[model samples]
Target: MQFHHHGYVSGDPRVRPAAGVGINRPAELPDEVDVLIIGTGPAGMLTAAQLSQFPNVTTRIVERRAGRLAIGQADGIQARSVETFQAFGFAERIIAEAYAITEMAFWKPDAADPSRIIRTARTQDDPAGISEFPHLIVNQARVLDYFAEYMANSPTRMSPDYGFEFRSLSVSDEGEYPVTVTLLQTSGPNEGQERVVHAKYVVGADGARSKVRESIGCTLAGDQANHAWGVMDALAVTDFPDIRTKCAIQSGTGGSILLIPREGGHLFRMYVDLGEVDPNDKGAVRNTTIEEIIGKANEILHPYTLDVRNIAWHSVYEVGHRLTDRFDDVLPDERGTRTPRVFIAGDACHTHSAKAGQGMNVSMQDGFNLAWKLGHVLEGRSPESLLSTYSAERQVVAKNLIDFDKEWSTLMAKKPEEFENPSELEDFYVSTAEFPAGFMTQYAPSMLVAAADHQELATGFTVGKRFKSAPVVRVGDTNPVHLGHHATADGRWRIYVFADTALPGATSSTEEFAEWLASSPQSPLAATPSGADPDAWFDVKVVYQQGHPSIDFGAVPGVFKPQVGPFKLADYEKVYATDPAADIFELRGLDRGGVLVVVRPDQYVANVLPLTATAELGAFFAPLLPERKAAAVLSAATEP
Candidate 1:
C-alpha cells in the first residue's frame, strides 16, 4: 500500500491505466514499474508471458547470465503443464518437437546375474482420460524459447534484460517505486554501472541460490537426499528395446539409472545415481567427468550397451529437498529502516531432485498463479489482499512436493541391494503414479474460491480441484474438442453450461438460464456487452447431450445465441453435442443430461450447480469479480 496522488491507495495493478492511454511501452529501466522478475528460466519467463497480456502493468525481467541456456536441463512437460501450454496456444508447437513419454519399465535386482538388474515392473506413465495431452519430453531450453517468443510478440513486447545481476533491495512509500531493486550490470551493452528499478511487486524466480529469498530473510527448511547423481543428455546408439520409453534400472550392487526419452534429433537423458553423498556438502561435488558418468550408466544396464554419439549436456549434483518458510516477505528501505516488500517464488521457494520432472513444471506453475493475481492488483481489478493468497496457495503445493520428493528421490537413489523389499518401491510407484502430472493439487478455500458446498450439483468435480474435461464434437465443424479448452489462462472466468436438448422442456429451461443470467445482479455474463464477446470478462457455452437428428442447433434456446461475444449458435462453435460424451458425465457423476460448472482462469472449479441454481449464478460472481455498475442500476430500477 502506498500514500500516493490519491490518499492511501493500495497499489492495485488492476486499476486500468487512466482513461485513453495506450498499453505501457518498454521504458528505459524506469525508476518505477509494476513487477520486476529475476531469472530467465521457464518459471521467470513464463511469468513474463503471463504479464504480457496485461499491457497496462509494467514488467522487467533481468538475468545475471548473459544469454539463454542452450541445452541439458529439465526436459519433461507434465500432462497438466501440457494443458496449460494448450490454453496459451503453444502446446502444439511443443508437441510437434517433443517426445511423448507414456510408458515406463522398472528393472530390479536379478539373483543370478548379481551385477545387472532385470525387468520387474512395467506400467503406463499417465492416467487414462485424465488429460488430452501426454507428458512431453522436450529440453527446458526449447520450452524457454517458446515462452520467450510468445512474450516478445505480446502487446507489451517484453524480453529479459541479460547481464544484469541483483545487488540489493528495499521497500519505500516515499520513493518513486514501492519496491526498489539495486542491480550491478555485469556485462552486455550496459556494463560496469549500477542501476535501480522500483516496482509495485517483485518476483524472485532466480533459481536455487536466490538472492531475493535472502533479501526477504526467508530460510529454507528440509534436508537433501543423501545421494549424488550424474545426469547426461545425449544421442545414443544402444541395443535397448525400451530406450525410447522412460525406464528405471537398479543395479544389484553399483547404482541406479533413470532414462528419460527426449526430443532434438533422437536424444535421451539419463540420471545415474552413484549412491551416498557427504550430507553437509551443497552439491556433493566430486572429481567426476562425463566419461565416468557414462561408465556408471553402463554398469546399470550390462547386456543393453550404450554408446553416446553426441553429448548435449552433463552435470553432477546431490539430490535434496528444501523449501522457504514463507513465499513472500517485506523489506526495509536502502537506509536499513522501512517496511518489507519482496516476494520469492520457483526454485527460490523450493529445491528438490529433478528426476521426477517437477522442478520446472512446478516453478512455471508458481509464476502462472502469481501473474494473474499481481495483474489484478496492479490493474486495480482486485484488492491488495488478493496478493496474500499467492503464498498461501503455492506454499502448500511446495510443501507437498517436498514431502513427495524426499520419499521418491530417496528410493530412486538406492542400489538394488539397498532395498530391503523391492516390492515396496513398486508399491510406491503404483500409489503415486498420477502425482507427476500435477492435476491433483487442490488449493484450500479462499477469497477467489468459494467455501460453498457443490457436492449435490456435481459429485466428482470438487470445488478446489481442476475442472474435468472430456472430448465433444462441435456442432458446426463437427470437429472434436476438449471441454477444457474454454478455461484458458487468459485472465477471464468461464461458465460452462451443460444443457441437454433431448429432455422435455429443455429449451425453455435453457432460455430461462440465459434470461436469469442477464437479469441477475451477480451473473458473470452481466458484465459482458450483450454477454457474447469472446474478449469479455466472462463467456458461456452449452453442451447438448444428443446430436444431429436427435437434437440439432435449432432446438437450443434462441436466448443461447446472444449476439454479444464472438461465438453464437449460428457459428455452432458455442454448442457441443456428440459421441463419446458419456465419459464426461460418468467422470463428473452427473445423472444424465447436464452439469453447470464455474471455472476460474487457472482452470479450478469454483462452484458446481444444477440449472435450477440459475438465480444463484449472480451471487457466485459477486465476490469473484468487481461489482457491476450495470447490475446496481438494474437493481435500482427493479426495486419495489
Candidate 2:
C-alpha cells in the first residue's frame, strides 16, 4: 500500500490529481520526537519496542530497506536471547516456527587410522537443570519478522518512516532537555533534502560500518582478522541416513560445516569455510553454487554420499572478530565535564567470528541494555551517571564473547593430523567438557562491588546487600518458575516481609509473612498465589534450638514468626542464614536503610544502596517508579 499525503499546509488547492502517475514531493520531516533509532535490524527494533513502553517517550525507526528481505545471515539463537524474547512476548512464537536441536555430536577424523571417526556426545538432554530452553535453530529473517510484527502492533507503532537512510548526525554538548539532530532523507524524489529533528538523545544502533560512529570519531580498537565463510540455506537430497541428526561436523582437512534442520519440512543450512578465497569478494563464494556447498557438506560427512537439489537462499560474508576499547573515545580534555555525547552499540561496539552464532544475540542484548537507560535518563528519573554504567556492564560481556569465540574457533580449526588416534581426540573432548557452558561464563555470578569481602555477597546471592541485577532462580515446587520472571511481572519494587516469631497455629511463619505482605504497601506480591497451596507457600521449617517443632509461643527463647512477635536476631540467622541485620532492616521497610536494592527488569540486581538513615528509601526509589510520584504516594497506589 502506498502512503499518500491526506493534507498539507502552506499551498494546496483542489487541483484533482491523477492516480497513475507519481507526483514529485519534498521530504517530510517530523517536528518533534523523543528518541531517533537508526537501522531497523534486531538492535534497532528491540530498542524501539522497549522505549515505546514508556508513555512519555516517542520512537521512530529508519531502515534503508523498504521491506523485510530474507538474506540468509545468522541462523542459531542462543539461550539468553530466547529469554529476552520471552520478556518481549515473542519467544513462544519464535520457538514454534523454529527447529529444536536436542543433541550435538562432535566427530574428529583419526590421524593414524585416517578412515576411523572419533565421536563424542554432547547434547541438550544432559544439562536438564541448566536452562529451561536450551538452544533453538531459526533463520535470522524469522526473528526480524517477529520483531517487526510486535513493533507494528505496539502502542508506540513505528510510522511510515521506513526507507529513510541516515546521512549525518550532530550531537550537543549541553546536558539540557533537547539534543539537536540533523537527518538527511536519502530516498525517493527528494533524495538530497536534509531534515533536521531535535531529540533528547540519539542511539547509534547502526551496523559495523556505522556512519554515526564515523561522524562522532569513535574507533573500534581490537584485533581484526580476515576470515572468509560461506553460509547457505537450501533443500538437499542426501543418502546419509543420519546426516540430519548431527549438529556440527568437522573434517580432517581443516574445513568445518554446521547442518541445522529448519521447521518447514526438511530445509537445512550448510556453513562452509572457503580456502584461500579473497575475503572481500562476496560473489566468489556465492558463485560456487549449491552443488559446491553440498559437495563440501558431503566431504565433511566423508563416508556418506549426498545428492544436490534445489537452492533456496545463499550468501558469503567476510567476517571479523574485533571490539572497541572504549564505548566512546573521550580524551582527558573532553572528560569529566564533557563526556562523548554520541554512543555506539551492537556490531559498531563489538565484532566477532560467526563460529558460535553469538554476534546476533550480543547485538540484540546491547540494544536491550542501553534502551532502558536512555529512556530513564530522558524521562529524568536518573542522573546521567547511570549512562556510564552501560559501557561498564556491556564491555565486559563483549570481551568475554570475543575470548569464547577465539577458543571455539581454535577447537573448530583443530587438524586431525595433530592427533595420534581417535582416542586422543576423545581426550581433548573430555578435557573441554569440564568447562562450563559458554553462556554460563557470559551470565555468571560476580562481586557486585569492586571490593566485597563476604563470599555470598560478592557472588551475588547475599540476602541483605543490594545487587545490580537478580538471577533466574527456581523457587516454586511443581513448576519451578524463574524468580525474576515472577518478580518482574509483580512490580519493580518488592517487600519481602519475614517475622522473627510465628503466631498461634502458623506452621513455618511463611503464612504470617504472606499475610504481612498482603497488608503492607507491597501487597499482592505473588503473581499466582492461588495456584500454589497455602501451606506449601511457606515451606520453610520453624524449629527450636534442638530442631523440634515448637508449638508454645513462650517456649521459643529467641525465635520470631511472621504471624507472631519478633525474636532475637541470633535465632533469625539460623533459619534464613543470610545477614540477620540486613534481613530485619529490609523486611521492616524501615527508613535510612543501608542499601536500596534496585532490581532490573531482567531481575538482576542493578545496584545496592546503603543508606545509613532510614529516610533515604523514598529519595532512592522516587525516580525509578513508573508512576513518577513521591515515594509516599506508593501507599495510595498499592493494591489493597
Per-residue accuracy of model 1 over 536-592 as CA lDDT, tens digit each: 555567776665345555655433443321222132456666556455555566545
Off by over 4 Å in 2: 1-29, 110-122, 125-128, 174-192, 224-227, 276-291, 329-333, 419-482, 487-598, 607-632
**Residue ranges of candidate 1 with Cα displaced over 4 Å:** 1-24, 174-176, 280-284, 330-341, 500-508, 527-535, 548-572, 578-583, 591-594, 614-616, 631-640
Residue 292 of model 1, lDDT score:
89
Residues 1-640 of candidate 2: C-alpha lDDT, one tens digit per residue: 1012333323322222322111221134465666777776677777776665554566666766665647537777866677677666677788888776666666656655555344544554224333455467788878877777665544444433656677776666554535566666656666667777776666777788887777677777776344555677777777655456535566675676666676665887767765545547555654675567667766777766666566677766655567876665354455566544556778888887766678788778777767777766665545665566566667888887787677665555556555456444334434443222223433323221222222222233333222222222111111222323333211123322222344434453444333333333332222213322211112112212111122344332221222211211121211221232223233324222123233454334433333121233333343443333232332222212
* Shift in Å, residue 533, candidate 2: 29
Residue 599 of model 1: what lDDT? 79
Error of 2 at 193 (Å): 3.9
